[model samples]
Target: MDPNEHSNRLSTEFISLVEKINTLSNRTRSSEQPFLGALEQWRIESQQTLDSFCNEKRQTFINSRLEELNRLRTNVEELACVQDVTQQNTNSIKTSIDRIEQDINKIQFNFRPLLIDEHLIVRRSQDLLPFPPSNQAIELTDSSYAVLAGNKQHLLVHREPTLCLLDRQLTIIKETSWPLDDISDICWSSVLNRFIVINSQYVFILDERTMVLEQCLTSDTVNWIRGTCSDTKLYLSTEGIGSSIFEYTLMPSIVLLKEWKSPVTCAHNEWIEDLKFHNDFLGLVIGRCKNNAVCFELRSTVTLNCLWSIQLEEVCSMYATRCCPMLNHQWIVVAFRNPRIFHISSGGKLISADKKCRSPSNICQIGSNLLAIWDQKCIYLQNLCCII
Candidate 1:
């Protein structure tokens, strides 16, 4: 049986017993007449038994999950060791492949010859890394993910008040406070040269260099911001009255551009969780559809037109996604609970999936490094270049 399902059953049974005990206590206390000694004694014994059982069950559930987590970690470490050995031997294999390719080229000199590009190939369970310890670790009250802000800087933000910055070594450098109490997400726009903070109700643009709030954009009819991404133009997802993607031009001032509503044809209710612009021609969005999670391909960012949509495999609980355009292959990572990482191709094909960590919430690629956060506490990093 599923561990989570077993845990849920125990929790439900405990809650029901507690409710019954509370009801019995209330009735006994408010009674007009005193209960018999035998009945009172039975009630006390039953309550004690139930409480003991509840405590036992809770501990059993916690222990079971911890064992499972440790097993997963062991497997990841073994895989990493294997990858390290494989990486060392890659140069020799590449040389052999190069010789074969040259021979094939000579044979097919009269006609167009088939060629293999290393970047186009996909590998399974190739990159799952535990994050290296930070030089100076700082914890925040609100659970959040760390984002690389370029220039060897990292950011860890809380929903309210605090936004902490870290240097190259992951040591706390500086922190900035804001009046906005609820920040849904923050994205550093390399194109716009600013950090855009989404607060559900409005959007704040902070100067990237100065880290000061430069401007605030508001919409009278829109709220419930889900996610945001930017190319030359800013793209925002809203789960307000209707789940939709809004496009706006940031230059000069924030001006409404185009809007695309969530597809009602989707088999399940949709909550557009993440919006990402792959380039001017392509964009990607991850969200739910019925019992499955799905990714939609927006062909045109300007018109917000979806060219195709693919349902992700083994995703019972949808979480986060990251697009790697630097690799030129547009490999996207679709992360879900059981904390698996599914690598989807540009054509919406599932290349591979890996159970990387305990609970992966978000993923991002900075240069050659792929970083992910799990269980609201741990961060994992792996270099994609090595796998490629």
Candidate 2:
């Protein structure tokens, strides 16, 4: 009985020791797992602090660089603004200098005055021959020495035609008499080298050098004649019954090439006072109907046609009409018998109207900036500045 009991007790004690060793092993494993977890948490926290410090350093560097760039941009903008202002001031100074120079030049030029003087040296009564004795004394034609006058009063000057030449002082240099009748108007033809005398029905062209008759043309009563050397054409204005007006042209061969009736018609017995050729196409005809200035144009085939006509406001009678070329042919100055001057375009548009002289009989260009206006008693030299 004793042996069996001891063995059983020993086996029980051994079992208890083995169970205690297993429980201690389990406790150690659980305590070690918690310490390892705490160490891992400390490592993660250190890494986060390092990353935060690095990020703050990077932000400071970026802010410093951005401030430097902004300062550089502001400096550049200020420099550009200063440069622009300097350039503008320089340009303003240059313009002012140029204007001052121009003003000085103008002042210097205007400081001096132009002087003109006329001297009369001689006077003689018989030395000056009167205009040819005719019925109306309508027109005059001149050669180098001879002047042929025509009129409509009685045509007596043609039956006993008188020719006269005068010097600059209007002193008679030569005189001649010819036998003819019924002369109406006279014109000098540079192309034919002749003097043409137009009667009521015929045109007589006399050679200027030889003083011999060259050709004769017969038509209605002629009122005016104008010669053009470029086309070798002579324009003639004829008076018809009543207010009818007709025009004709003579060619180089003294043959009538064109004849046409004017579109402008006057009242009963209205007459054209003067006729002038401004150029090849433009013509001026002054008449008494309402005191109007009639303008005509030579169109295709040199047929005389009316473009536009204007009646002056204050003039009741017109005696002469002439065109003064100016401004490189851009403008024309027309002078009427009532001393009214008008600046008109080539197309018959009136630009300005004013009185220029007192009783101006004839108006002609004497120089680049002057006009010579003559009356029955005196001649005036006028400065035409605004018109030019």
Candidate 3:
């Protein structure tokens, strides 16, 4: 090589090394300091987790006490039935008294003050604006409908002629046309790493990575309305009165696991508009056919037995009701026909409700602290708050 060429090459290499070193210095902020900052953030998050765990335990303890008291009351009531009008044998009376006494003793023990860390509590924000925050929304075509949260920080949306994948910021990543019609609902199957899309008669799976769509012949032919998925199972509900929910396995094929129908699903006159599964429980929205009487029910996914039911208003609508999972096993639901949003506990208790938003049709939590809500024409992104 020429002497001048070698000298220029050495000079270029030296400059490049210095630039790389500067970049590393900027990224690490002197190595140990950046790591220490990250450690502090993790510590704060760990404390938050501990606080939440303590809160849940306190609630569980209270619920157990209430259940035990109910049992004791029932036992006493039965003991009172020892009226001569009703024949109560000596053995039966003794057994009832023993049961009541045992329950009373247990209740007395639990009635004592609990020693726990009650540091974490949720409160409604002072500026609880029920409308879209900062008007951060994306407009869609008139034919667009339905939005669902995917595994990553992305969303699946259906428009008139195509299906689109969007990031948390409501920016479209890709759109494809597989010619689907009457798209009822879409759910992400974490086990399959794909999306399960349901219409009235067919089930489709879309690969989020490739944006490819395909039909699942294994799915049953039914009038499907809305759907939700667990890690291992895909659950779809039907479209009419006395709507039935079908459970299918996520492996091998979308094979049938169990088919739940009314009154196990809901009363004969009620419609199953929306359903979501969180952990071991299933949340259902059942609406009366002829009127606007709607109820949110929590049930066991294993036994399909009702756990608790809470009455709600202005939710059942021309569009199916929505149920999105919230942190700590809570749910955020919407009133589509009217403009109302609700926060509910895992045990079917109303935490709070916002009588704002204009014609809110659907809602889904995008990431941990962000929320995505949509109506007919636009989708809004907002900072999620745990409103009391």
Candidate 4:
């Protein structure tokens, strides 16, 4: 009764103790699983943070290097332009030197001695030359020589942010300050009796009499090179990937008609230098590198058909072109480098040339004479022709 019962009871108690220990171990294992999961999640988040920081640093370095390279490239391009201009000036000086040398050689070899006591009186007369007398000139403040436009009665001059209307005597009759950012070019429309002013982004129409801003028009393309207006439409020259002319009708509602591009093959880098319109013809002065310029005339309407084209020579710079209405034959005045003026026929023939004006930038017909601005400061009134 004593030994067997005691041994059985001890065995049962040992078995119970084993069951309780197993339950405690299972609970401890379950609790440790959640802690281990939380620890693993923390480790993963730390790794992601470190990776993101490293990527950010790498991208920043790359962007900084790209910006620096772009700046350097811009500087190099500027240097190249300066070098080209320097070379051009050097060549110009060399040509002048050669001309002077040739003149000296002619004087040395083919000298003609003047007769003594013979009075040689050179008669001065306006009939001898085509240019009119330099009657009036007025200096302006930082004016662009390319901003001369108008008819025979009034001359419109743009002095940046301001426009000046002058009389035949080169006196400023009216002055109006432009409210826009800048003005790239200006033209007068006799039919609309308004002045068209253009910037790179917008075109502004102004009343001729009151000189008040009338209407503003915008274009999809940027960089408007020049503008011209007819009786019923306005023509704009815009330059981007290529050169193009955008036409807008000036009726009840301003409507975009169409865009015109030159059918003539042009280099991808070609740009428009100047634009002019006369009668039913539109003239475009296109330029590339120095001495690479072409004058083209096409139909002034939406349907562009090339009538004539002429490549210009000895033109270091081509700035502006104007159609002359007083002449019987179609003639346009083209201003070239060193401010030389050339009369070009519609058929591309080089007519009379004038190099008397210093740094002529623009030309227009005023009365029976040609009015031109020189060096962005002085204005000259010269006869269109001296022959009777």
Candidate 5:
């Protein structure tokens, strides 16, 4: 063959070798591209798996915490409910205890009896010649027997007659008789140290030391007499077809001071129940008129006003009146014949009534906290708890 043809064949062989290398390089690059794409897909799948695991763990933790919180809230609500029930029970117990205590106190008071102390004493009178009951004439002296006990020991009067002394209980230090006949009333004067005995028309003053008659008083027929040492005045209630109240002064001899006519025109026909003076300006008078109790007030020596003029529900055969000292003014205490104590104010106002008593003469205040009541045979001391 020719040398040119041989050189051309060699070049063709070299060109074939270069083309085979290029084809091999393209095939290797295609295979490497597929592997790289698969590696990137694996990396993305691994990251997605890690993210799903983390999200599931966080959800589980949140669900557990919520369940715990719900459980704690339920426990707190139950505790509050229990506390409310316990409080209600405590209040109920307290109410029950208070009620029981009140009931016990009431029961104890209802069954309790009056208790007597060392301050109480009793003495009996010695037997003497019994005076006629029809001769109601009696007198008391400053040196005579003490009719009232306690603080009233200073109330001994001077010129009272011996016959006018009622329910006497004394040691009988001395005794004397008066010459006056048909004695109507007797009173003792503490300031004058004498006894004043009243007859139908005259009043005789007798000395306690010498038992001698001192002075005599001339006046109209005196029905009742009350002595007041505060104003140095003597009130004499006169009787006629109509009754009248007269005030007198014993200084410089017995002289009439003032007079108050009866408000009721026919007071003499009616029965006089009681008469008392709360003070110098206030006087109380009670009488029975047509089966009714008429209570009236004498404000001054001239002003007479009827306060409460009403009939009692029960027929009162006898009535007693007393004035009780109060913080504001004097309260009137009235004892009916049926043994009922009625409290009335001096202002014509009724306070309380229907306080039952056993006897008219038995109801008396022993001290601040006790009341002495006579029940016909035995004396009952009552505890004045209401005052306490």
Candidate 6:
């Protein structure tokens, strides 16, 4: 039987036992369905209110302007019939014209087209990914691995046996073993054209062309769990609760630039599981040590202030979670314990709750068209056309 089978069955039975009657409030508290339904109703009501207001104001505008319009027409008819211009009639016509112009301007402002954009109209979809992948799932030779795509040219993966640099087709171009200690997380530095790997406090750079791994020792001590890079900065997350995140320079040499402590990095009791950098912002996946409560926050890289945050799960067993940057300024977060995938919008809203039927451990978007998913059984490299 599956490891969680018993728990799943018991939970379902317990839910059935206590569900005497389905009340709106109780059901609403535990699930988002009711709130979503309410939001739809609210939107409909809001649109109806707007339509009613516009229609009422429109009729009122027409009613108020009809008398002025009639007077203007009468004055024009009278002026045309006179044919000869006198100062008194000329002044009267000028006054009527001025009033009509002002009325027209007000009418134009009130009757303008609706102000809305494609961004607001685009509906959020819970579309399952792979969208039937451009190609089949390329099950890798290794059961478990670390895969990352920084450049469009190559993909990197490390297993217990060796570190492999594969081409876009997921074919191994070159392979190497760790020079010193085992590297934990891998990040790509586009500016450097290199991959940065972390082994706790130690830092290393690997060249895919020759498959060589070398250390760039900062000689500092901390629990570095994950690493990701921007054009200029290298961001690393720590392990254990109240974990800290360190920022380093990718310039002259790998040097400490700044340190983000607890409460700044995350709540004092929570830890950062994964982090990704995109468009001058850092995305942090914060998790708890005791339960499966997880949060994905988008923050400003300049000030480290949270722009927005979303709670992915309320209670889950401590499991590894990963965040990948997808096309169109969005995120893909996968929780390994429950084997579920969450697609998030660039604005920190949960776009979809896609459930993965496999026991996949982690996933990554390799460039624009490819996605890599790895587990204890195998690795899957699918197309990202629709996933994004």
Q: Highest TM-score, which number? A: 3
lDDT to native, each model: 0.56, 0.46, 0.76, 0.65, 0.45, 0.73
Per-residue CA lDDT of model 5 for 76-99, tens digit only, reads: 567667845676655655565566
Q: Which candidate order results from sorting by lDDT in descending order?
A: 3, 6, 4, 1, 2, 5
Q: What's the CA error at residue 163 for candidate 5, in Å?
A: 4.9
Ranking by TM-score: 3, 6, 4, 1, 2, 5
Per-candidate TM equals 0.56, 0.42, 0.65, 0.60, 0.42, 0.63
What ranges in model 2 sit over 4 Å off? 1-162, 165-175, 178-184, 206-215, 220-230, 240-252, 262-272, 286-288, 291-301, 306-310, 316-327, 330-337, 347-356, 363-374, 378-388
**For model 6, how does the per-residue alpha-carbon lDDT over 140-259 read when each residue is reduced to its tens digit?**
555334545446767777755677777777777787876545556888898888988777778788887767778785545676888899998888888888888788898877788888
Candidate 5 stretches with Cα past 4 Å from truth are: 1-152, 155-200, 204-215, 219-230, 264-272, 296-298, 305-328, 331-336, 353-355, 361-388
TM-score of decoy 1? 0.56
The best candidate by lDDT is: 3
- Candidate 4 matches the true fold with a TM-score of 0.60
Which residues of candidate 3, in runs, are more than 4 Å off?
Answer: 1-132, 218-221, 385-388
Instruction: Flag regions of model 1 displaced more than 4 Å.
Output: 1-156, 159-161, 227-229, 240-242, 264-268, 296-298, 314-326, 334-336, 368-375, 386-388
Candidate 2 has a TM-score of 0.42
lDDT, candidate 2, 259-360, per-residue tens:
545344334444444444444553444455443544322222254455655554545343445444442232343444556666555555666665644444
Which scores higher on TM-score, 1 or 5? 1
Q: What is the lDDT of residue 224 in candidate 5?
A: 45
- The segments of candidate 4 whose C-alpha lies over 4 angstroms from its true place after superposition are 1-133, 143-145, 262-267, 296-302, 316-326, 367-370, 385-388
Q: What's the lDDT for candidate 5?
A: 0.45
lDDT of 3 by residue, 223-272 (tens): 88888888888888887888898988988777888899888898888888
For candidate 5, the clash count comes to 13
In candidate 2, how many Å is residue 300 off?
Answer: 6.7
Q: Which is superior by lDDT, 3 or 4?
A: 3
Q: Candidate 4 on 1-388: residue-level lDDT in tens?
A: 6999999999999999999999888876773664455546766987898799879977875676566556555655676678456666556556655665565467443436634332321222223124555767777667443576777688888765578888878788888987766677888776667778787887777776898876577766567878877777878887543677778887765678877765432345676666677666666666656554545444535455567666666554535444343343455554546555666655666666667746666666665455554455666776444322
Cα deviation of 176, candidate 3, in Å: 0.5
